[model samples]
Target: MTARRSMIRRAAAVAAAATAAVVLAACGGGNDSSAGHEGHGKSPSPSASAPASASASAKQGEHNAADVSFAKGMIPHHRQAVEMAELAETRAGSAEVKKLAAEIKKAQGPEIKTLSGWLTSWGEAVPTEEESGEHAGHSMSGMMTPEEMDKLQKSSGKAFDTAFLQMMVKHHEGAIEMAKTEQSNGAYRPARDMARAIITSQSAEIERMNKLFGKS
Candidate 1:
């Protein structure tokens, strides 16, 4: 009986050992499966995020030579328009002329800043006041000659009103042309949108100025 009991104890111990081995193997397999799932989850993170990063970079940097030209040309153009508008503040004879000049100044001043910012970001030169003055007499569409600008500056009352109206109408027409060119050729969305705005606003202002010509 003693030997049989001893044999039974040894058999039980062997069975327990086998059961423990089976349990350990199952736990290890579970751990391996969980680790595999974690690896799979992490694998796509970089690739998934890469496209979004690339797309954002592309959007921020997207621009062309036309966009550069548009900003560079329009900066000086807007500065001149603002200068003309400033002249109208004290020199204009008609309330309507003053109101129109104020509107022109309000609109073009921000646009000049925007254009200068773009040029600066693009590592291009912004036109200085002296540079703009130097090119004032150059044939850039409807740009007023030094003689014309001087005459407008010297005149006041009805003469100033008439000159401002006539010259502004012509200047607005030039701006429209430049804006149209940007709309046609620019790749930058903001610049193109600004160009469209310029075209619409200037066209309307041109019509208004034409109507005010003789009245002024």
Candidate 2:
């Protein structure tokens, strides 16, 4: 009887140890899965983050004098377009003309801000409202003179539609010229990208305006 009891006790102890080992293995598996999930949740380390940021800054600052000139010249050039577009709200006769004016104002307004921001970020001076003469005859393409702006501001109705389309077509043509130059000579990727966008959008607008002029 005593021998039998000893054997039974030994069996119980063995079973208990086996159970503990199985429990430990299950817990370990769960912990490993949790650790793997946690690793995926973390953000990229600073070493990786720094290089991406530095590369973008480098691209922005890598520009040549032509890039700087483009931004400076284009900012004011865009501002004049916006100014002309705003005049159409009160002066334009055709619904189509008004719509186009609004589109130009909407698009160019933000572009002006973007160009100014790039200039500031690149350690270049942002163009001022009164800086028309500041660039020493670099002459922004597509920009209206003060006299032309006054003339536009003074007109109304069908006369306004005719004048706006005529002037804007010429203006867009000039902008395309400048953008082409930037695409060729500009160094900054973002500036070059902006140039391409200008070329595309303005080209389309030019076509639309030409159609409108033909109908008029």
Off by over 4 Å in 2: 1-61, 132-138
Clashing pairs in 2: none
Q: What's the TM-score of every candidate structure? A: 0.75, 0.70
Give the per-residue lDDT of model 1 (tens digit) for 74-162.
88778888999999999999999999999999999999999999989889998888766757448466778888889999999999999
RMSD to truth, every model: 4.9, 10.4
- lDDT for 14 (candidate 1): 100
Model 2, span 1-216: residue lDDT tens: 999999999999999999999999999999998999889988878897898898888766588888898898888788778878999999999999999999999999999999999899889999778875434224766666777777888899998899899999988988889899999999988899999999999999999999998765
Pairs of colliding residues, candidate 1: none
Top candidate on TM-score is: 1
